[model samples]
Target: MADETESGERGNVKTGGCLCGSVRYEVRGELRPVVNCHCSQCRKTHGHFIGYTSADRNDLVLAEESGLRWYQSSEKARRGFCHQCGASLFWEPTEGSSVAISAGTLDAPTGLKTVRHIFVAEKGDYYEIDDGLPQFPGTMRGHPLPEA
Candidate 1:
């Protein structure tokens, strides 16, 4: 929805917070569509596949960050969470144009959809991805699924 910011410009502003409301954030402008990541690391961190939507780093504003904590999940990225409620919230790469936001943390009516699945090769064996969406064994950046 369009929101009026302090600058008086109407923008696509979305708000979300941690389970305890200790880590609130606002995103300005558009957000990327949701992408389900089934990587083992993501499953371990979120207890399942993690749905993420991304936005430019500059577009994310921390409205409240009293409980924000970061864990360096890998050499290339860090995970952001709320220490108070243990909400797994973000995945930010060491050098990237955008930061991934946990889809579940965003307030409802997000107007987003999960378009595809990534890291499918590492997905847990217990669940079947029956949604029929495109699946990639790894990232889509350079690896596209072979023609069926």
Candidate 2:
């Protein structure tokens, strides 16, 4: 179990919350680069593409959770949101300690960058992904999720 600070990163602590401010949280580890997910579930749940950055579960601390709710989206995954404001929040693998934090929920100065666009085949018909980053037609099973 290596401490997050051992990565030569700063405190590696970032605070974020839902739109209504009722579901604040703190992430205290290294965050993977932001990935724009265009899977149908994500598009529908967020009413558009969803951006996320992941961190180990052990490093996350919930400071306030009064409005948080978790929806088991699939056998292997769950989605989290704010009940008070309907703000999409988290995505976590059911069997792992890692969780994906909604990139939009983090306060500015995130010090993060978009690493890639995933599930592009299921993207909405209304828009195009022309941001110049690598676009994968599906998940990162064959392809790898890039590190920041």
Candidate 3:
């Protein structure tokens, strides 16, 4: 099985839009392994856990200029969405290595695999994560786990 730490260069891929098909995006690099975030914020935003993958900011290209709004979710992070239809599209760092895109937005099928589950402790009470993937109790930077 593929793991989260796996790294490689991404090539151009077609990706886009919300439920209403009002937004579109294109990425030109390898899609980072998927990350399953069980954090409250993620669950609340996505109506469940959020499955996402990161890509270099340089590789992210938005094809359309309409229906996008950026919300500053934290001091260093912001969430992008469709202003008209309210679709969560991207998660970007004010300053970081890459921007995370909703994996569901990709237009073509990808080989990306999910490696870890974040905020396991704070996951919703109604659901149980039985995937046996690595689970962290908090944010990625809050604690360190032994190297795999």
Could you say which candidate leads in lDDT?
A: 1
Clashes of 1: 0
Candidate 1, residues 20-107: lDDT per residue as tens digits?
9999898886788888999999999999999999899999999999999999999999999999999999999999788999999988
Error of 3 at 21 (Å): 2.4
lDDT, candidate 2, 1-148, per-residue tens: 3343432233557878998889988888788899999999999899999999999999888989999999999999999999999999999998977999998887666889998998999999999988899998989767776657
Writing each residue's lDDT as its tens digit, candidate 3 over 1-148 gives 2222322213445465676766877777677788888878778888998988888999888878488888898898899999888889899989977999988877655667778888899899898888888888887775543332
Candidate order by decreasing TM-score: 2, 1, 3
* Winner of 2 and 3 under lDDT: 2
Query: For model 2, how many clashes?
Result: 0
Residue 136, model 3: lDDT of 82
Using all chains and alpha carbons, the TM-scores for the candidates as numbered come to 0.89, 0.89, 0.83
Q: Which lDDT values do the candidates have, in the order given?
A: 0.88, 0.87, 0.78
What is candidate 3's CA lDDT for residue 96? 79
How close to the true structure is residue 51 of candidate 2, measured as C-alpha lDDT?
93
Estimate the lDDT of model 3: 0.78
Total backbone collisions for each predicted model: 0, 0, 2
